[model samples]
Target: MKATVYEGPRSVAVKEVPDARIERPTDVLVRITTTNICGSDLHMYEGRTDFEEGRIFGHENMGEVVAVGDGVDRVRVGDLVCLPFNISCGFCRNCEKGLTAFCLTTPDNPKMAGAAYGFADMGPYDGGQAELLRVPYGDHNCLVLPEEARERQSDYVMLSDIFPTGWHATQLACVQPGDTVVIYGAGPVGLMAALSATLKSASKIMVVDRHPDRLALAEEIGAIPIDDSKVSPVDQVNEQTDGLGADRGCECVGYQAHDPQGHEHPNLTLNNLVQSVKFTGTIGVVGVFIPQDPGSPDKLYKEGEIAFDYGLLWFKGQTIGNGQANIKAYNRQLCGLIQAGKAKPSWIVSHELPLDKAPEGYQHFDARDNGWTKVLMHPDGGSHN
Candidate 1:
């Protein structure tokens, strides 16, 4: 099997590794047909997140089930499926309560939110970036796709992560119908958040970013695009809102956000969000933040004390929702929307590359290349595009 293995800071390559096979009675083996290199994966590539070497590096996956173990009944061989990025045991304490991301069955680790595929500090489960992936607790993890999933692979593939994540951001932000919403970061996730905001019928959707390309896409979605490069994003939002700010805001940049000049500034986005949001508004933080940075020391992130404007947040009576998206909680509904032809998250994807080109894909994505919104990788070196 070939996979994109993380070597070190700013290093990744596609190489042959052992083929994935069923490992437990509840396991299933899936041939990797579609997988994505997400913004989250950038953490490991930049060495900002600690993960062991030789580990596979992809989690947003969709594929056909090639094999299944004895205990698997819900999914079988030849069935198309999209598994959640989080590897929850269904019966775990947290999973039973609908918190799959913090499943209690997660293997012990000093560093990790819980078990995850292809995520550093998340778990030991290998990712599906290769030709095949062995899924533990297959019956619980795999979401059998509709009949058209094969035809709409690219859109369904997004259901594995970003789409659901964007929906989660909207859900966390408490986006109400007729409400005004603002989101920071026009990256793929942020853009999807803006698109998802449309689904909730938010009256006004505003996205802040310095990139013309990203902001242009925001405008195409009928959302207000605020180019922070020209002026403070808060100022633009306030000017548009008549100083009332938005009813809800989303933080999609996480810790990797940069100022207008492209220098890293972890708190800049959130601070802008705080000022651009109404006094009682909620903010969803979906951007990844970490204690270490291979890029350099960012003032917002200390060993543990990330420089956050909690003082202002507290003063403003703002509610904050933070953490990873529990992908299972939302993938199904989002899938139905895609099936209905209402949402086309695939629009964010800029390239479809064969497995062999993963090295180049990683480089371009790492640099956030122009028009490189998303890159979908397939094991066989081809795709729907």
Candidate 2:
């Protein structure tokens, strides 16, 4: 198989690698059609984490099942399926409770509780950024797509990560119809969070970001764009909500949060969320914050200890919910919305290249190039909408 191999900091290349094959009865072999380069992958791509070299680098994936293990009864060969970023055994206690992201059965380390393809410290499973992928717990992990999936791979593929993750943010923040919601960051996940808030009938949706391209995307979906580069984001949100703060807020920037000057502040977004939201409102965080950030200039961030505003939070009586999205818990319903022509996440996709061009895609995306919002790679030359 040819895969996008991570060589080092800000470096990747397409190289011939060992073929991925079914090694267990529950495994399924997929001929990957569409795979995505996610914002989370940048953590490894930028050398911010301890991601090993020579590993593949993709987690958002969808494809045609080429072969199914004998133990796989539901998913079959020739079925088009989208695999969630999380890999888990469905019979585990967490999975039984719909907390598949924290499943106790799939991590490489027994002390850990979750697993993801090609992610650092997640699992030993290879990612789907190649011509082929080996799916574990085939029947449990594969979300079989409808026949119409052949025409909408761009939208369906989002069910693997961002769309569900955005929806999960709203769920965590307790977004209700007629509620005023404010979102931090205007990246793909943040844009998806804006979209999710729109679908949930939020009365007012405000998206904060410095990028003109990303803020423009949020505006396209009817969200009020707050350009932090021009003014204070918290002030803008307060102005929009008549100084009451938003009813709900979401933090989507994670540990990489930075100012216009490009100085990284791991606690920037969380504290901003606290100040931007109402006194008794809820805050949902879906950003990627790891346990340790060795590359951080701040010593506390080096130890993964963010100086959060717990005193302000306690005084305001605000609530917070943070973690990885339980993708399996929402994929089915989100898929139905796509199938019914109610949602189209492909609107954010900015580039689609063949597998060999993955290196270019990563370079542009990691640099945060203008208009390079989301990039998708086609391994088998399939173009989905």
Candidate 3:
């Protein structure tokens, strides 16, 4: 099988690798149809993380089950399914409580509670960016899609990660119906956050970013776009909310956040969120903030430390929620919205290429090239709607 292997910093190659097959009684082998190149994957692509050179690099995946282990009872061959980025055993204590992202059974490291396929320091599981993927604990990990899944692979594939993750951001911020919400970053996840807020009936939605294309996408979905390059994002958010600040805020840019001049600031979005959200308001941070950032320009970031305005956060009595999204918690409901034609997260997709073209997709997305908002790869060259 040909898989996208991480070669080094800002480099990837489509290399012929050994076929992925069922390795355990609980495993399911899937013939991957659609997979995504996520922004988080860029962290590894840029050599920011300790990702191994030979490892595959995709976590957003969906496909048809080609084979299943004897222990798998619920999933069957020929069933179209979308696998969550997190791989968890259903019987773990965390899994029982719907905290599948922090499941105790998947991670090999005793100190780490969560595991993701092809992610740095997550686990040993290979990703679904190739022709085949071996899914562990298949009965628990696979979210079976509806009969209409094949026609909407581009949309349904999002249920694997960004869709649920964006919804999770709103859940963390405690976004209520008719509440005013401000979101930082207009990337795919941030755009999805705006979409989620719209579906939840937010009275006002403001999205901040320097990219004109991304901000335009947010505006297309009824969100007010704040171009930080032209105006201070903090001032814009305050101005939009009549100086009271937004009722809720979300941080979707993570640690790789930068100014319009291309200077990286590890704490840029957090401080922006703290200052933009009203007193006593809630904030949710779903962006990836690693424990250590060896490649960051800031000295403090070398140790994964960010110096944000925590004093003001305390004085304002604002609450913050941060972590990886428990995708299983929201995927089912989000999938229902897609099936009912109420939501179409695929609107952000900007490119669709064959599996062999993944390296090109990664290069363009990494550069944040014009019109390269999102890229989906089809391993089987299947038509995507």
Candidate 4:
């Protein structure tokens, strides 16, 4: 098999790797068709985490199941599936309660918090960026896509991570009908939050970001654009929401947030999100924040210890809900929306390259190049190839 391997900071290569197979009773082997280069991967690409060299690095995956272990039941050979970024045992205590992200079954190594196909801090499983992947607990993790979806692999592939993650942000923020929702960061994930916000009947949807292209995508989804590069997002959102602030806010920027000067401004988005919403509003923070940053790993605990105005939050009586998205909880409904032609999240994809081009895709996405919003990669072989 051929796959992209992360060699070091800003270094990756397309090379031959071992094949994937059903290694456990609950496992399924997926012949990957399309996978995506996600923002989360940048944490490792930029050398901002304790990621090891030569590790596979893609998680947003969609493929066809070619084989399944004897214990697997929900899917069989030839099922076109969209694998959730999270790898969880369906019968775990957390899994039974819809908290798949915190699945107690850590990988055999026990150093990783949980297991994901190809992600930092998410265990030893190889990513689907390869020609094939060994999907653990495939029957529980793979969302079987409809036949019509096979034609739009790029769009449906977003289900693997950001699309569902952004939707998760909105849902966590308690976005309700007729509420004014403000989202910080108009990245692909932020744009999806804007898109999902519209679906919820928000009275006004405003997306903040310096990138005009991202804001343009937000506009296409009926969101008011806030160009933070030109003026303060706080000023714009304050004015747009009549000074009371938006009814709810979503923080999609996470710790990788950058200031105009290009330095990592970790708490800027959260501070803005806290200030952008109403007095009693809530914040849905789906963007990832590493508890320990490798760039300045000395800050370790400080990496997650964002210095924001909690006093203001207390005074305003606001609430916050933050963490990873339990993707399995929402993939089905989101897929149904896609199947009905009601949502086309694929509009966020800016590039679609062959799997061999993943190294280049990582470079473009890492540089945050304008108009380079999202990239989808298709491996060589199997169904949909």
What RMSD does each model have against the real structure?
Answer: 1.5, 0.7, 0.6, 1.9
Model 4 C-alpha lDDT per residue in residues 1-385, reported as the tens digit of each score:
9988989999989889888878989889998889889888887888888778888878999888899999987898999899889889888888899888877785556554457877776788898889999988878898999987788897788888888898999999999999999999898899889989887888999998888788898998889999887888888999997899999999998887877767777888888887888899999999888776646523533556767889988899999998889899999999998888888898888888888788889998888898899988889643341
What is the Cα root-mean-square deviation between model 4 and the actual structure?
A: 1.9
CA-lDDT, candidates in order:
0.85, 0.94, 0.95, 0.85
Q: Which stretches of candidate 3 lie over 4 Å from their true place?
A: none
TM-score of each: 0.97, 0.99, 0.99, 0.96
**Model 4, position 107: C-alpha lDDT score:** 58
lDDT of 2 by residue, 86-204 (tens): 99899999999999999899997989999999999999989999999999999999999999998889999999999999999999999999999999988999999999999999999
Please identify which of the two predictions, 1 or 2, would achieve the higher lDDT against the true structure.
2
Please give the lDDT score at residue 172 for candidate 1.
90
lDDT of 4 at 136: 87
- Per-residue alpha-carbon lDDT of candidate 3 for residues 23-77, written as tens digits (9 for 90 to 100): 8999999999999999999999999999999999899999999999989999999
How many clashing residue pairs appear in each of the predictions shown? 3, 0, 0, 0
Candidate 4 Cα deviation (angstroms), residue 310: 0.5
- Candidate 1 lDDT over 117-148, as tens digits, reads 98877778898789999888899989999888
Stretches of candidate 4 above 4 Å error? Answer: 109-113, 297-303, 381-385
